[model samples]
Target chain A: MDCWIAMCVPGGASLAALAEVEHRVLGLGEALGGAPWVVTHQVRAAEGGHYAGSLQTQRGEQAVVQFAELADASGGGWGLVDGTGLVRGGGEETHMAHALASAIAHRDRTEGRVVRFPGQADLPEQLSLEELVERTVVEDVVRVGVAEDASPLLRTNGYVRLELADGRVRLPVIPWDDGEVCPFEQRDQHPCCDGH
Target chain B: MSGRHDHPHGHHHHDHGHDDHGGADYSDLTIPDTELRPADVSRRRFLQAAGVVGAGLAIGGFAGPRPATAAPGGGRGRLEGLVWLNGDHHIHTQYSSDGLYTVRTQVEEARRHGVNWLVITDHGSNAHARIGVDKVNPDIVAARSELRDMLVFQGLEWNIPAAEHGTVFVAPNSNELTVLKEFEQQFDGTVNGWGAGTPANEQHAVDAIRWLGQQMLSGRTPSALFLANHPARRGIDSPHEIRQWQEADPRVAIGMEGAPGHQAASIPTPNGPGSGRGFYTGSPSAASFPGYPLESYRTFGGFDWMTAKVGGLWDSLLAEGRPWFITANSDAHSVWADDRIRPPGQDNSAYFNANGRYGDPVSTGTPRYDRGDFWPGYYSRTWVGAADRSYMGVMDALRAGRVWVGHGDLIDGLVVTVRGSGGSNPPGTLGEKVTVGRGEDVHLQVRITPRRTPNAHGDVPRLARVDLISGPVTGPTGDRDAMSAPATGVTKSFEVRGGGEMVINHVFRAVDRSFYLRLRGTDGNVSAPGSIEPRQDPVGNSDPWQDLWFYANPVFVDVV
Candidate 1:
């Protein structure tokens, strides 16, 4: 095998040895006699910007690819291509460096709908589903007023955290505003509560 | 235009720094408690060339008396100084394809600007109810007898556009609209469904807002109060907005606007260049930043559910006691432009220039004061809470945050303390950023009264101050490409990568809205500046359309 340019050691990271030397250089010119000429495989990524993905090859040589924005490096961590020359490092190509780091962690195309909501305050950046869209909706006046401290018994930053439809954190107000009134959050706190 | 006009604002108190001290007319022009917000640039150019007497507004009340003293640190005692609740909700009189501004000059400028209330909501698509724009000013609610002063209500603002948010009200009637012809005849598309109907979604405007919230809970309509209008916006079908309700049909949406045109900027505490999250000292998008949209040209200019807590939607709806309420609106939108002020996202006009930058060719002067011109209500106002000066006590104190807001400067004796307790639940919980990351969501203190007011562009407004923004929630991470719902994308990635820091205070929320920073004069623009967006970019602000004023009443975490 008279190598014109070949180094695909794909064994993982360094991009799995450049996908096992680009599958042993197209099976080494059909096993190493030479002459089909033309297998241009290039693998890169020296540090960060990850750019974000788009490089796959299993036999379908999509290689017209050229990237080199990482200038300066050579204790063997390789890298430094201003005019374009040394790409080196297949040192073997382990299955296309895990298929290009799992396609550089691909994932793109999402408009909405997973609804995982639970913490981060169920996140809509501020929790609001609009009662799913609406049915009996009503509001005449709820006015609670208190940037904290006109009452509620003072200090500790004070206290009043409510929403828990299922698991329970309930508290609609017990020693909340000041004794005698603590409906604990209604649904069943009953007639002001004597127990029922 | 002759300086020495010290500062009383809104309906004018005029101090011009003691009108130059012979002592009688009060210092004709000395105003220096550090210029207490600016006596026309400290009498320097003295009203530029003396000449803004345009005046003429006066309507239902306050074209005259009511100053028993007290504006500097204003009505203190329990701290009632910054005031704020003043309303407008939406207006557009001739039924909004472009409202002319009437209904007696929108209740005589909400009673010659004394404003304690003035909803007249308006805009449902306009049928023109005798055009009083719904009504509400009885001489600013009969000068609240002994000068408790100014008020007005009637209201409307339903503007539904097929619903994702947008609701506003004062209601007793009307949703106004027709021409549906078919599309199941309309409901969520609003014909007056105060309950906001449901179930229609292939998107014909959310199925006409679910057939107009089921024809307003089946009664067909009336007895209104509704809210959710700017509950963090999102429409044109559904960018997936918020203001919630639909657990089968909860109705009236309840309140949330947090602070609609809310000038934006606060939550800064910790040494602040605007607190945290947003690294890349070298470049991911940093042209510059000392603390503000001045982060060179980008980093955070507006979108404040008081600082992104809509990711928790008022901390899971106030933990559990669900009574939920909050307000502040200017939602204004009628423009011709030579300079009406408009700029952020720029729908009603001004402030959209897709990078090339606009007016001043895009950024002509120092550090940024970019006043090429757009306008839009000028800067700030909203404090409505009248019982005698009524619009149903300013929509029952805007459903009930009691309300408060001030920008450019003005507030007198507005108290709001957290955790010390008073008439209701004080025992545990009040979140936003996981309620201050579990320290118990409460820590706000404000006290105002500084003078130097004139924003809608009479110039004068360099510092203004007052912010209490907060944050913390990230856990969800399943990744799905995020557009909101990774718990609202962890509220703008927690301070935006710096990981945490949210405290925009000067007292805010539930009636304690305070102010008084007032810096006045000098177009050097650094405390909150911008200029760039010559405009255009269909779906490429990168993915930003949330900031209809941050998300109402932030404060939610883990919630159980």
Candidate 2:
């Protein structure tokens, strides 16, 4: 399936740099669509700088998904993306797309930028880059400490980031005020400790 | 809270030259049971001399079109000869971009489910502003003729500025469409003339209410009113904003939803839609009021956090000495457990933008576990004690605060009366302001009747307990952003036997200061003080019939 992506290039980004960022977003979408974790996933660009599409599984479970850029987090290049949408059965597509977006946004950065993704709680049993892309997207991952402002942003997403076994942080996707608590039993067998 | 700015207070002068809707029905304001405070004959003589008694007879003049047929009914709290009309002010039809049914379908469903009055509030959009608003009037007028007993109003779900949505409705007349169409064009946030959630747009929200008031003043319609819907869904409806809306047009800006619709959402399963109760799953955004807590973000028992909290934001407004009332509605877009699905092959946006072609309601044989809402009037009911069953009667009662709200047929009848010894009349019903001598005491009489028939769900609702909440009318706070009422709370709770009607009476000795008392009843399954405790936020419950509640407007006692 197709994914929609909107890019906000940094203030001084060149035309060539902007084109490269757009090309990378398309590549990331294509990688996610080709992944085996999802039964079917597609994204397409829509009006208003939003990507509107669908993601489904072999079990007939699916979601009407939309993805958009929050802001230009990439200082002079492409930035990581944040995703939110209603999921049926599991939010694997939403989780995978968001992780891929983060990995893509942070692919070439050298400042040790720590990217935060939503649904820190909904990560799959085996959290690995291979599940999302053809091969190693990043050879060496920077385990930077969580940013101080990450708490507030995570709070806005109705989650408090968790310090996983490998010092990675993730958010609980659903906000509390929505009145529906996450009903999964993923806490006991968190994906962070499940070896990549 | 400390750094907040205070808004300038509006002039409190309200002229009382108009005739009260029920000219001679004050005697019907009876107390089934009584408790009295001792005062000399001079006390009765003094109240008569001071014009404190029977003053409600001349309260803000109601000059509106009278009902062609006035049904007769006798109830303790109703205006002498008037009756109670249960209604829903917030409703949506196919005209609303997200709604699924037509005008006729909504009216028929609501009437069958026991609602006597309903307002057709399609969402305000540029398309609506251009053509849809004018187009829906003939259907509404036709519906009114078809169901002459039911009052069908024309309204729009206004995209209120700097905050949430509100219901802007008027007493239906030939000019109703003209007024709503123009009003939306001028003040709606989605309309091209104004932007969303800005200070200027906030002021325009106030301007819009006053403009509706102007419509009433110009005799375009007998009455016009605006009510904020699902206020706490986004924490943007700040205490100051609410205070400002009321101060901007006290007569026109009435109250908000005590219980929001979508009662059947958040079904506890893997594939459920999980929109949360009332679709209120939003967290604090850039536009949110920072003062709200994490607990304020969610719905408790299908109600906004403000109203569910015994001494919460709603009480904070009432503590300011204004009659800011509360209501419940369906916000009905698609009914819960619905069987239809969006016709296959169309993209979400395409189906949404293309209104009628979305799909027809062909049952798929299996219940749509993901759909999250109830049809209007099927579960939530806003009961207005009106002088008559006409449009003006309903609007005037709402403006007067003579209303009670219920969910899942929790209680079909509720009468709350506050009586002063010196008043020659029986007592003052919900929303009336009564006066008594400084040393004289006041008594409260509360009665509730269980629904005789089962609800649309076919389950009989059992009354659990009634909570009587009272607080001093401590005027407006010094800090405009104050969001709590430490002084207001559940002073007493009366337990009921499951089989029948129940009544409770209590007397306050020498109530020397101004204060107001209101009532709330629940099924007792979910009960807490002020706000729902953090751990008790029920997230995945799908059955609305299991957790039921009813709320009554306040009855004020003014001591001189």
Candidate 3:
């Protein structure tokens, strides 16, 4: 079974630091005999915003044991969560992860939001945001366990599950950044009219 | 001069001593009644001689006597007895955080490049507002006295709240420094922490323009102007923000930069910066207005997309019958391939903060191709047609929209006139309005003087084609974010063959609706089907010299 281990580092990490953290997470997953591990940087807009690093491992039972040991060593802020449970949990943890990511990546688009998957190459330098979105394959998503009376913020949350027309699970995934420079959020940003 | 009083400069008292031909009303120097044709005389020479020419006064082989009927009274009529002056208003000096060169060096360079007037618009910042604004005034005053023929105005590149930068300048006066310092401290986005894209911040931008107008109205300054700079480069200047600024105070926020500075940034590698033209290589951000397309982040034919696209934002504004104008300038922080470098040993940011400006640039002797701008008047120029060559005259001309902008010395001069076909009524020139009887035909006559001399790049530019773009006055749109005027497009395109003065004429027959017509010309180096097909400029490596263009302000024809 596939499962995700989420880690929250209260303060935001730099792009370089996040890349190193992904490398460490991948190494730890490999040491526990979990191959095919994917680590993504999740930008969360809670506690004044920070990046929550999450790792998906195919050897879920072993990876959950490793997450427990790591959480005990690091003294907290780590969790072993099922992808389906997170989407159907209808809890604050699910809402926080989904809404913050949506605010950053899907703020402008009115249609299906762009969620990055593993193995996607870094966007070619100077490629515009429009071109990047055009090249990405947008998947149909079905919201599960979302209350109709949810606030506007919750309605825009990315806590969605991919479901086929017959109500079978298509892909259990969460919105993630592949540790690459998002075209929407450039690494090199200057204040308005700062003598570019 | 009924509507002349409506301008902020109408009650202007010229306190500066640089107006050599003081207080002379040249409006009376009309064309003489008799026919006198001088085939070899140039317009400049004729104006200098103050010689009265007859109905068929010929100058530079393209002059034809225009009817001298009494112009319509509201000062919206054709400007008379004018001299065209070339200038740049978006120049920077060491007062800017990212800038080099001193005020004297910039003024001297501007004079050497044939610019008659310039404004030192150092970037607005915390240090700039606190000290740089006041520190730079003495240099400007000295430059004015030393270079009596050149007009140097003190201004700042305002970090407009929730928008792009703007050139906010005032006519030179006793209150110039005080007004500028206070305005920068109170309203500069960087100084006031209003850079975010929020409703309150957007309103602050509008309020800044109104404050400038208030300063002018209260007699603190004779006149003031605010032109949004590099508006489309970052995609932050939304159409609604532009409309709000213009509507805030039409007298102050008169226009925007048609083509941004840093024209040389796209020069190919091993010789130039090899970056996107105007350094316009970024993507949209959260603060950016969503309606703008990806193409808006780039330059088309070395012009801002808003101005380059025929039926785009600029047309959208003009179609509403608003009198917003366009200008081109060298937002010169440093010159491309210049040998000047900041003095050695001092930490730049710390030094600037401590001393209010960088030490004067030192000669490096080795040219730095990585630099991304051209000196003022080296690559871009804004031509203003003024009744007199005084400070107030230039300000009045700009506010009146009697202006046209050119790049790379594309053309030596341009004269556009629109008249009622076979009627004796006075014609409308650039930025003027002519009331015509409904259904009456109108003739547009354009006389272009091609460059007889080589540009700074050591090549004489050739005029290849001229495009006439016109659109209906659809009135203001219900959606302020509207960015397109679908009805506006190229009505005609003229191909050029020789270097002599090219005269082109087009007639609008049986006109029924109120409309406006503007002109744009190119060297035929790079182009696609304009705003109709909505051509996109390629990403990078666009050589600024290879693509030259000139845009003339429009003439509105009011149908009654």
Candidate 4:
């Protein structure tokens, strides 16, 4: 039931440690909070700009965990998915807080979203961190991932399919030549960005 | 028309590329009945040998991407394949007050999303006009090649009443939609409004479109591609409009807009046919239109965000083996927020620039028409399937049914290939199907995969379903005299229900721009949003301009 779990500061936040990282976290502690869940993540920073982070929850299971802004840490990357193959309990785990709101979003409502491992990827150069996150967000939207309520800015919170390379992530999409008309909003009717 | 300027003897191309996703298959179904005529196809091949598209692309390389998805099973997929591109043919500009755009900016944005070629076909019916292209097309080509790699071209859209009930397309950005508009100008005096208190006519609309088709195919080839602009969406008394149009002309009215604006308008009506003093109306539905005061009008429904439902029309035309293109126009009236087109506050001044001043010296400078707001952005687009990336090349590629309609996205990347038992192609249409009345077991196969586009916010739409609208005919000539009757169309559909990867929304993700995967349904009636994204445009029955979203002259194969 935990809406969010952050190891360190969020996106682009220059943080030193994952949990102690200063960043904004949403929907944490929304689920059963009786148990404690271990967290790990990465953070990023742009010289003077505030640091940012991304949630990479894995292995541990808890209701919610706050990964506040990390003014006290260096900037670069956010949470890391506990890939230790650690035995993390199961429940309805959502990708992001809003993912938990929309049933069509995450499969783990109370448990946790099973982090996906990179099978193989040909990561490109000149790829910036924001662009990497942007790509992941795009991949998720392309796959209809991320719950409706998921923040448009949180590429990972909405099931962004990130392809981790050297030390970055981005969506893997190639333009097509001929095919059916793009479904309306795929390019035109984006609900998240429409000016209303 | 005299003061107009266009690329005198040239055309430009933009930077359109294909989507890079895993492959999609259409081999499970039968192939098209007839393919493009060898000689004509070869004639196009000859043009390709000359590398028109390539040359144009080399020149207009700056025009963003305009790549077409390779049609699978087309043997060419066997030929090392090429990249997918996109294009948007039917767009309007500030010249049409009801619109919101300009030629330069229009072409610029096309480059931004990587649309190679763009045709600015503003509403010529309206008297409102613009000071169009100068020595700028080539400059645009050079600049786009330098910037977004997009192509820019000159095109004029005629908006005369479809007495013929048709919409026509022409070249030479300055070339007015004279065929029909001229007569109106002469007959009605005023050009854009309810000219001399005249009601919109179908005959005029049809003749204009049909004639364009005739001119283009018959060798006259007036740098033009006349298509029926939102035919079924507006033409009332369906049967009457159809019959009259067909009788008048039948050049190559490809398709009407499937989704012109970002979303088709949904009209609302009273609970039931409110028996009025003189008339009756349909049942009440959703309220979409804002200021029109629908609450007061009870006899009929409001036609706000109208998306054309011309399947009945396209189906019939397809029977003859003609592959008319399907298209969409933004037909927007406003852009409230970021004119650059972001989410949550899209207020395009093209419809009515917030700072528009009716008289005096108009702001003449960079971004011409962007601030004008008169039928601007999000209103025009058409796809072509050509051997090379040139006008003639794409034209030849298109007449053969290898195209799609993208209201906002360019029409390059996503390609549509229908395979039946006939030759895989034709000159005017795609693979030929026996022309007969409805009655025979025919198999159709369609496939589409995800492709990349301008992922600004990175929100891609999920293809809920691939709708196959089989009947409908279009062209400059109104609805080509084909009377629409209360006839039910027999259909065969295929669902992309194979792997969990192919499922939509849940799992099946279409990286490709469009959603029509050549699938069929018992009674394929998706919500007003249909396969289009956003699905927020009001759906209504009133304003014919906005409501009618999509239109395609299906490759109809009669089974008698």
Candidate 5:
């Protein structure tokens, strides 16, 4: 059995600090002895002159982790939401499963593919994250470890789609480029002069 | 003073119709007294009123007279009557969170660098709206009174909702502070939590422009102007948004920056910051307009891609017969390689949140080469042709698009005139429109005075080439996001040689429809095809000093 856990940490941090937060979450998963995979890291512009982000993760049911205690350790402003009922395997229920598989493959640096339903051959080899969601059916599930090392695992750019109130939002999962910092999250790109 | 002084060198060739416009005579020069406020009259106007019109006309604060060199066969007295005031509208002070200079320091530096007028546009934020706007006004007022020769305006760098930053300024007056403070509190994106990319937030931007127009209509401020700053840097100022801003209030939201600041950011290694020129190295974000291409994120020859691309966004706006103009300025936050740092023992964040500004910066006695940006007027200059050297005069010129922009002191003077061959109507200069019968012959005359003195880099920049770009007036587009004017291109290129003033002429034999013509020149250090050729500036490591360029406003030839 699998369970989904959604956690949102309040307060704004630099890009590097945000990355460290993600690392700490992954480390917590390893300590719990559960194969945990991050689905998406949704960073958004928040009030009070900074940014706030939410991270959603999937873990094995056997891991009975104290989520409330983890929230306390990070900071006071943390919200935990249960995603178990919303996510399931197969059919339209496989949306979260595909999202989870995509992140797992991207994290492990393995090949991943979306198992398309029947009568969907005309779709191109690669699609934008938005186009993929609009074109694919509910039965399609993303599978990992499906191709050789030369080719990209997922048919689309590395974006994890999260279902929000305003439909599906895609966030880019910037891959580790041999320790080269992501330009968007450069350490030196601090808010200077009116918080640009 | 009314008599014309002959040049020492006998290279004058006044062959082409100098008699029509009175032949370089200073006696007939009339100074318009309608808008001249007592305080607005300065040394420049005194020189003009004294009938000092010749090659020895002292420009700004430079000592002595620049050699009066005329282009052979060029029209005489092209720059008579109007005073060309060089200025920078978008500059930051200590009020900005990331800025360091005081209002006095920036003003003195600008005056020393030959900037006749400037605007202190600190960023608009929650802290700024709360206290910074009111606090910075006294400094600006003091600078204005102390340096009566320099025109200092109080403005704010508006965080336009769902778009890029812009310089929102009004003519200096008693009500200037109140209007700006109210505008920022009511409309700034950061102050109102409207920084997201949504339709509602976009509407907020349009509404803000309209509100400024309302202020002008209600006579709160004598004049106001909003020029988008670094519009293409973030790729968030979509075509529709720009179009909407102009449509909302063409008087207020007149144009955008043709080139952005932070030019020293890409000056290679240990000597500079080694980042992208203009600090334009970021990729597209989720909030960015999807229509913008990858190359639009970088600067070409230290200019924004929107203006650098010949027939791109700027031309697209021009084709619609919109009064959209472009300017260049130093969005100076912290001067590059300047020996200044924030005072010690001040927690910047805590202090800013509490006091609405950082403590005054102190001299470190060591230049910080790792920083970015040049002082105002050190690199970029927006030359506005005003009737007099007044606050309203400069604002009116900017609003009328009677302006030209340059980098690295590429040219000292530029005069563009478009005339109908029939000679039935008066000739139109930059930002003016000439109405002529359909199918009438039209010609463009460009007179460029090359830089006689060395630039800040101590190198006299030579104008190697001048390009005459034109496009037809195609009316409005159904697609609001349209960003291309396919018919616009470099119609003519003139190879400039020698150090003397150069004049290039091009004629449109029997023009059929309405069109507009503009001019741009380069130093020949960097070369590529026109915008139609789809050439883009390379990514990063562009030394702004090595590749200098200047862009002049357009002159429309309307076929009646």
Candidate 6:
């Protein structure tokens, strides 16, 4: 699947509300069909009165959505604002359901969220909360590059460590240089771990 | 400044009247010509002829008492009217993004644990500069009024532009908040989005310190002080930065954390907040100063490796005859056994920004060692010998280096004096210099009072031994990152017997030029020779109450 999915929550959304939004996004795979998939989302508290994001879903088209109060409308609910900024004439629930279904159907190519090799790959079409936590660890470990000037270093810190399977794995979060990998020199220097 | 002195054979009379180095400049305190040398008289005449008098700071001193006195409780002439107030400067409250408790909660807990003075240092976050500082101000003022006996200061845990966190506090006044807000807005690396260690950021840090000094001088605040916190936690506070900070503004940037916070971090996990000693668990990073020895990355006997390593970075600073001091702090965010936890319904934004839901504070009867820190006055403490309880008095005492730091309630009180080899001469305490004749010997007298009651943790700490360390006071080195101490070592150790108050004396033979001596005592729970790492319990398993130690500032001896 190759597509984009974007969403925006109303301003002053509570933590519970944000979690609800996350739950909805994570369940997109099951909503579309009984399928195994991965998705990545960068979540942070929004400052202004609205939260907006664009996601590339499996629908082959990236869709951007926003959840905010409708301007000048007497009664309000979710509706598809056309590319020309005109809302489609439909009820909130019907419009929201249709928009989500279409975005979910537009799938991007799937890939592993955590890889064993250095280099960034494309983001997965869908990611679960469990998988999100796993990706954090993988990123943390790989982020601690072996050399002083590690080519593919993450601006944010490193990945967590739990299990290591064989072969060279790669994750999509970092931009590792092509055909360049330094041995784990930091492994010998670290007081505890041997980065093997 | 030359030829009137002799050494080696060491038979010379030390006037103890005037000093050329910086130790509370007392030229005006003494009557003119009382102890002026023929050479000084001639030089003054030459300067007067050149019409160069009154060109700079007049070297003026207020009418002050003589610098040295005898031990009061044990002997004669000890420093009088000095009260040892147990306090901490590096503390955090809910105003900090990562901190958890409110100002009232922090002050109440600190007072319950016997803290007479404390500085509330919330981290320098964007919100802190925008509104957090103002939000915490009223609570701080209310706490000060309610806790009338305690001195509460509003300060920020600054993310030093190129280094680690430091405590930058101002004397509480109408303009205090304004000064602090502007300072943070302009200099705080975290708030300004320039915290990453870089050359420009390092210069900004130096400029920030100098600006604090400017504030004090410009009367925006009556007084201000800065102390580097958890200096070696990340090994990013390079020796050059420490020196440059002091050089930038000696009055504003005075000392660093000798023993960092997170003292209870040693407690095993599932019960303890497992950050290891001083929360020192991370491997060296690109920003880390490369000159730090391997041992500098770990803690020894619950103290930071810089102070624990005898002749390490601290000694290097002292060796340079600079007034670099060190203190201990709880850096308390949440105390060990704290029961409140952030509810599942709230995210970090609401928890910190809006002060959302948190579990009700529970009783201490339930043990939760998983918490990483002890409240102010709970475990780590710095006892400052101030003249009064006011902000400036405390700042003056801190600037003068009249203080001692302890961990786990290691001792109730520590009194150390360096005087002429006997009870006949006046005594000089830590951070003061005692003048001695070329051939004369100097003695050190230490009086330690064991704890009368258990600490907040309910542990009764006992002293095992006190070690005295001394080193030559050689001025600044050529290499800024130098960490070697070839001539510094532990001179002697006094073992403690069952005690109420123990007084011991030591005498150093044939005096030389400038040098310093310091003190440290431990409960014998953990011990290591020189700079070796102390034996720590297995990770995720240890008790905060078992180990204890205390360190006092150094007293210098100047040979004339």
Interface RMSD of each: 25.1, 15.6, 12.6, 21.2, 9.7, 16.5
lDDT of each: 0.28, 0.59, 0.68, 0.31, 0.67, 0.61
lDDT score for residue B156 of model 5:
93
Which regions in candidate 4 have their CA more than 4 angstroms from the true location?
Answer: A1-196, B1-84, B125-149, B162-167, B171-221, B232-239, B242-249, B262-325, B332-336, B339-381, B406-443, B451-457, B467-553, B556-560
Give lDDT: candidate 1, residue A160. 19
Q: Compared with the real two-chain complex, what DockQ does model 2 have?
A: 0.04
Query: Of models 1 and 3, which has the larger lDDT?
Result: 3
lDDT of 5 by residue, B13-70 (tens): 3332112222232222233333333432332232332223323542222233222111
Rank the models by lDDT, top first: 3, 5, 6, 2, 4, 1
Per prediction, the TM-score for chain B is 0.25, 0.82, 0.86, 0.52, 0.86, 0.83
Model 3 clash tally?
A: 0
Q: Please write out the lDDT profile of model 4 over residues B1-560, one tens digit for every residue.
A: 12122222333322222211111111101112133333234333332332333343331232322222112112232212323345665555444334444455566655654466665554443233322222223433454456444544444444434221123443322232432233334322124332111124444445444455343332233234444443322222243443344334322343444433422222123311111100111111111111112111121111112222223334333332334345544443332122332122223434333322111112323232222111323333445555555544554444444555543221113333332233333212232232322322233433344323433224232333444544322222344434232222323333433222332221112111111222221112222223422222221222222211222323334232
TM-scores of chain A in all candidate models: 0.15, 0.19, 0.41, 0.20, 0.37, 0.29
By the TM-score metric, which is better: model 2 or model 3? Answer: 3
Clashing residue pairs in all predictions, respectively, total 193, 18, 0, 290, 3, 61
Q: How well does model 1 score by local distance difference test?
A: 0.28
Q: Per-residue lDDT for B1-560 in model 1, tens only? A: 33233254323444342132221121223333344322222222211111111132211122222211111111112323223445555433323323334344444444554444545544443232222232323322343343445444444454343342344343322232221212113332333432221223223443343444344322222213455544332212122323223211222344445444313211122211111111101111000111121111112223222223322334333323233455444544332221222233432312211211111112213321211111223334544433223334344344333444433323322333333112222211111111122222333433333334444434333322233333333332232212232222221111111112222333222322111111011112222212211111011111111111112232332321
In model 6, which runs have C-alpha deviations exceeding 4 angstroms? A1-196, B1-78, B342-347, B350-368, B421-426, B529-538
Question: Which is the leading candidate under lDDT?
Answer: 3
Q: Rank the candidates by TM-score, best first.
A: 3, 5, 2, 6, 4, 1
On DockQ, the leading prediction is: 5
All-Cα superposition RMSD per candidate: 26.3, 14.5, 12.3, 24.6, 13.2, 15.3
